[model samples]
Target: MLKFDHVSKVYKGGKKAVNDLNLEFNKGEFIVFIGPSGCGKTTTMKMINRLIEPSEGTIYINNEDIMKKDPVKLRREIGYVIQQIGLFPHMTIQENISLVLKLLKWPEEKRKARAKELLSLVDMTPDYLDRYPHELSGGQQQRIGVLRALAADQPLILMDEPFGALDPITRDSLQDEFKKLQKKLGKTIVFVTHDMDEALKLADKIVILRGGQLVQCGTPDEILREPANEFVEEFIGKERLVQAKPNITTVEQIMNPRPITIMSGQSLTEAITLMKQHRVDSLLVVDENHVLEGYIDVETIDQNRKKARLVGDVILPDTFAVEKNALVRDTIRQILKKGMKYVPVTDENNRLVGIVTRTSLVDIVYDSIWGDEAAAE
Candidate 1:
């Protein structure tokens, strides 16, 4: 556990990074520090590991004052990953991954095994161990840097925008992977990012900083549902209120469940008719259990009418869809990417529970942003 008791940091020119901050991080808790650039998020993280000592106030790790501890020893016990990766070009991937283990004088055989295991954990092939840092892609190299930090088996991990440089798709995959790894290892993690979306997706708790001060600290749902102040709410944007969150929300909140269905044995014409009649873009094809077979789009029906095929011939299976409880934010993100107006939401039984159209999703987001006025209305 870590605690910041009235911590404050001022630079040589009297610039304050953090002001009278009081915070507590429970054991094995993953906390994210997020805000605009220069808001002292990184300053707070570095103070924990002693990369930058506070100008005033006390920082405690395990209830003991951190300032009294040896900086080098403290850093050795903390895993750190920065945005630039900073891997040594002369070192092979294996060496990079095992840097800490080697420094700790791990046995040659053990270091090799640890490096191999970690490389595989980060999705690097076994053959990659022999290659140098420059041989890998930016994303792969970033993974290596992160794996390197964890190689030492540290109790705390500090990550500052670790995935900021990667493409959106790669960043998303890495975020999911990090979540899995964290769940397995359960380290006390302090992550810093400017991205609200990333903070929401990965953080167990979010710490929002503004103008060198703590604004709010709470779980993702807590912060999203009840922002602490006008600044916090405005910073996160009122738009997130109705922002569709299908990943954790329900179809009933944003679905047109009664407007769409597909017959087990009907021509494309019937499917098209059903969609047009209901004013929906797609129809759900179901089996005896009301289990969803797939989705039949209006375009699919129209293009294949000459073949006398049933809805099953062109239904998009669950493989191409997401759960009904998926965050509507992510759902709308994907829809916007394809410039589509609809997404299917299914239940655990794989039944076509309901359909979420763009209009519905928009309404949710709109409501989230403007709910204050709506309540008054």
Candidate 2:
């Protein structure tokens, strides 16, 4: 949906911020632009909305040249998000989110409804609509920034390190959340980040830049498997290269085939006994046919013990799980990135087959990194 044709941006001096970038991004694709300082990733993204005008060549959005359009009107039709969040502290969350809609002269009731609908996408409650930006956490504020970008339902969005200021845990959560949202909405995104992990996790295609030029552009796996040059290889780092090796093992190979589990119909007393016997804080709840239902933990059981009887009554049904045939790398990313203790593995029928724990991953990672050399030694 976005194309960069022989694009070049040169400041007043002889410095070229972007040098002849020729690239095209497809619709609904998550495109990440990444590089070191002064590499022109941000400059390239800003040029999309005419925030930074190109000194040479043309940029087209769906075959319409962006430079030909009115800069202000073009910006309004596109979404832009920055690292600083840029939310007005005085404005309520609803007002902040609907800022663009208000500019479009949308009716008050329509704007309010839009804000509510957008907030629901991130699982935020309607009560937040009336609260000011200062009342929300930093992560929540960043979320608001994203919502503001999506306020007008723009087909293309530009994000310049939008999560750079957040803590690592919050950043990972937002990355996962935003990736899911992008898939659901199917908006073409041009994101700028220096973080390779973030680029790999979020981008459908990665555009790596250096010295104000495109060094390499490919999927994360492609770049990892066969880096174009020494610069690209070094930038990707050796650890990631090793981790992305071809013929990588699958989750089923490393997962524990028999995890501690209990029937949904089992009594709370029985659940407690099972937990104690297995020395586990929780037990996976499965049906008689071994289909995954959910899970019950010691804390959950204790909290509901007085009011609840069966394991099914207290089970938390929203447990994150993985398919048995999933790649080990993906499973590791899900568990480590989300900070989960373990992820249950299920078969095609949703039957509980196994579980992968953090400890198991640690061993597997060590082996992947040094097993051959260690064996030789």
Give me the candidate number with maximum TM-score. 2
Global Cα lDDT for candidate 1: 0.82
The global Cα lDDT (0 to 1) of model 2 is: 0.91
- lDDT (Cα, 0-100) at 197 in candidate 2: 86
Candidate 2: tens digits of C-alpha lDDT, residues 83-185 = 9999998899999999999999999999999999999999999999999999999999999999999999999999999999999889988988999999999
Candidate 2 residue pairs in clash (backbone atoms < 3 Å): none
lDDT of 1 by residue, 154-204 (tens): 988999899999988788788879888888888889999998878888889
The lDDT for every candidate, in the order shown, is: 0.82, 0.91
Cα-based lDDT at residue 17, candidate 2: 91
Stretches > 4 Å off in candidate 2? 264-285, 293-320, 325-327, 337-341, 348-350, 366-377
> Pairing residues by index, what is the TM-score of model 2?
0.85
